[model samples]
Target: MSLKRRLELLEKKANYLDSGVKIPQDFKKFNELIGLPISKIPPFKELPIFGYEMDIISNIETHRDYALNKARGIGATEIILRWILFRAVQNKIPGRKFLIVTGIRLGLARDHIKRMINLCYNIPGIIKQSSQYNITINNSEVIAIPANPAAIRGYENVEVIFADEAAHWDLLDDDPVLEAIEPHRTKSNAHVIVVSTPNGRRGFFAKIFHNSESKYYKDVKPWIISEGLLIDRVEVEKVQKEDYYRFEQEYNCQFLTVRYAAFPPEVLAILQSNSMEYQLSD
Candidate 1:
């Protein structure tokens, strides 16, 4: 049978075992191998203080690939990273791995990993101790790898791919890091999440955001915040009247071109969401 078909069988057998029906003694071991209850797994909601639209997470849960480019302070990285951790731990499939790739140094990478580790450690019933936080409930690995092309090419069978700070990578050079991981997602249920704040002008992220197939192009869940969000409209006009063009376009989520002008006032209205209603204490 194909790997996909075999996995389906294992899933079916696991469900039957969960229902407490009597299977043959020989099949007991197989059930133990595959069955992973949610209560015994780590809860991902414990990480980071994110305040984004519900529709954003809904899109991620439904469609696996997302290319999100937005202004800073939108909580893009934290939201996606938390989602990755949540999915990895909640469904404890053996050999499952989630890789977080970044253009920053290894130390910075560990900072994010450490946040995830602490979240897992603090949650009481969700995740039991399993070799610290580097490994998950059923030995599923949540790893952070640097953006070097050579290092990324070695991994296989990764379930989720998160490319953070994507604007830092050069799109013209064939993007070996993306090339290596894209093919490994042969499973129909794989997820690829790319997120970044605006950086200068051109890059791999810019191309992806422009493509029609990209989630951004389709307007899955756009929450564009610019100077208008932070400062009063008339106040901004007075502070940088001559350079208002620069401040509005760069700090705001505006796409600058020679002929076309700033976003119509109506488009910004369509993209913006209300301030996040935080439930972190819950």
Candidate 2:
């Protein structure tokens, strides 16, 4: 409103115009460098990417066998979903096939796809096409299958497998699934991302966490994420009395059974089988 303020604003606009900021070609550089929140852009503005979220994205970019064990509502699926969109606009991705194991069923995973499509709806140059079990982008394809309640086995030609909630999955020994995922590692430098809260301490997810030190896998925990303001210390303290061990597993990323737990780790392991008894590959 004032003359001085108007002059300062004009100078700022002129300085911005004069600034020589090249548009980055690489997605990582683009993301880390100059990519602003969708809200910064008019007409299609959305939310900003948080620090912890960006760290997860970085992990996805850098690691071949990355594992994430984080609390609920912490945004694991979201960061990856956004990353997929970024890749879709990249002209081509590093791999052709992307598989998402829901650890429950394709039905449970359905919401994820819906949200993904919605997120990309206003973004230019990115298109999402879905079939019964697969979603295809420009040069990349994403498929989702279940690991429990019913087994969906025989994953073939998979370049990346996003194993969601691996702790809840039924395949304890991980026969067919491991066979499918591990082979792709050496074959394609394919990334296998195992994400979950601790169900107990006797499954494929447990193995991944315990072997976090191994070269075969890289582990990421929520505490390592700065700007983790979403975690309220008071809320965590309040929930401790209700279910302490489960809380630790879910929030602290510990692999332990809950006190007075209905399904103990042993029973869970007993019901779980190594072999994929019913192979339903799509």
Candidate 3:
């Protein structure tokens, strides 16, 4: 603890006693004021964050849309949930809705978010409740949904949206989902962050990272990433020699061509020649 944090918490005590209700004005200090690093929260035992990781989190505070490409087991969900909590507690609007989309069930998403909910206990007048994968923190409502067009397409008035494990999304190429997700974003300039490990060489996740300069995209580089997951360097070295592609993209955080074509060259050549053409002669 630093002198600055001591002063901040002292001020919080005065403010809390006056009204018995306080909404933190500066979310940048929320984590510090809470007096608990993410590690001590629960489930997570430790977090070794780099300086770049701190900078990226600051950048995300103001960006309208952002994406993070991280290696496996690199704790992308923890960073994202922290950002969402900042947005939720800082915003004044009720019905300030949020969405968390995941590759499958909401287990992991639920876990990270539950940690955020625990921190709310320290903040006075903050109302929170949880049922399954849905949580209400202060005035914001967060609902975790599967990553599919049907789940994403119909939502409206969303203030922020997060796509977790985006590379594994089933409706990756579905235009309708994009159509819906894209519209509200433009209306409110909603914040969107997509976090994932590299999977295939194609689809929405791939497109966002590869085309970062596109008008609506803000590509966020992974700050906490290493050259590779050197769990046991000798063993990892042997494994990488046998499966280099997975090692690079899955553990090393490089989004290369780890995936292969669904159709082989022989089949693709046949389709190319036929052109799937249809002609009618009367």
Candidate 4:
């Protein structure tokens, strides 16, 4: 299918999921379907990404055939959680499924799922627990499973797939989770979202983000704060005084001249907590 048509289908599915419409036999098990209101769904507080809105509406409005390579604490997790919750409350397929793969295991997975539920319930009429292992807003269906690639063989046709901390996911030798989830994509017009900070110098996430040749590589967006943008003028001089050029690059996301830089120059530039205290008290 053309990417545009695929994106249109994706947008329709997202709208259906968000509005809490029941899936018909073509997309569900039965003929009749229902509708749920947006107020009854979980609400997400949008945050700044490179100073732009989180793009949840746009992200949900189309099929995400791409991945997100983001800095840590950049609101990637929060948005993905919102999308998964949307599906959980309104899935149409029999045994309609949503899966989250983290670097952690079952106990942690359950904890994360509970946190999502709390976020959903915290929003008032948007979400409520229909039963254990089931969350509903306007009859959406969502379940977050802690998965290791080796153990993820049985689940099929997952409607939404999220890979968290994906930079660390490559350490697993038998990552069947990726394999298991691929078939579901064509069938469900599946939405796959992967988010992580750079882990090593390179890996799956890195290759996809850095190298355009990878099959999964679609669109790449990088967010960087230019040097001197966040740093105080006084502190910039202090980093120069300390000769910590390497410390500055990592945090500031600047190009570095240092070899094997553990602490890039940009970070060192911003490391002047003592000076801030000195200024505050003075």
Clashes of each: 0, 1, 0, 27
Q: Which stretches of candidate 1 lie over 4 Å from their true place?
A: 1-51, 125-137, 169-174, 213-250, 255-282
Query: Which structure among the candidates has the greatest TM-score?
Result: 3
TM-score of 2: 0.68
Q: Which 10 consecutive positions of candidate 2 have the poorest summed lDDT?
A: 32-41
What are the per-residue Cα lDDT tens digits for candidate 1 across 128-247?
A: 343322445444677788776776667666788778777655444536666765665565356777766555445666667566664432222223432232224564455347665554
Best by lDDT: 3
RMSD of each: 16.1, 9.7, 5.6, 14.7
lDDT of 3 by residue, 36-69 (tens): 3444334643244544456557666666667777
Off by over 4 Å in 2: 1-47, 91-95, 148-157, 223-228, 261-282
lDDT of each: 0.55, 0.62, 0.65, 0.50
**Candidate 1 Cα lDDT to native:** 0.55
Candidate 4: segments with Cα more than 4 A from true spot = 1-53, 105-108, 122-141, 170-176, 215-282
Ranking by TM-score: 3, 2, 1, 4
Residue 72, candidate 1: Cα error in Å is 1.0
Residue-level lDDT of model 2, residues 166-275, one tens digit each, is: 77776646545655566667766667777887777777777767773655445556433522344566667666778787568777778786567898778877667734
List TM-score per model, in order: 0.59, 0.68, 0.72, 0.55
Better of 1 and 3 by lDDT: 3
**lDDT by residue for model 4 over 33-131, one digit each (tens)?**
221112211352222222222353255446455566553333446556754664555454656667677755555456657756665532335554544
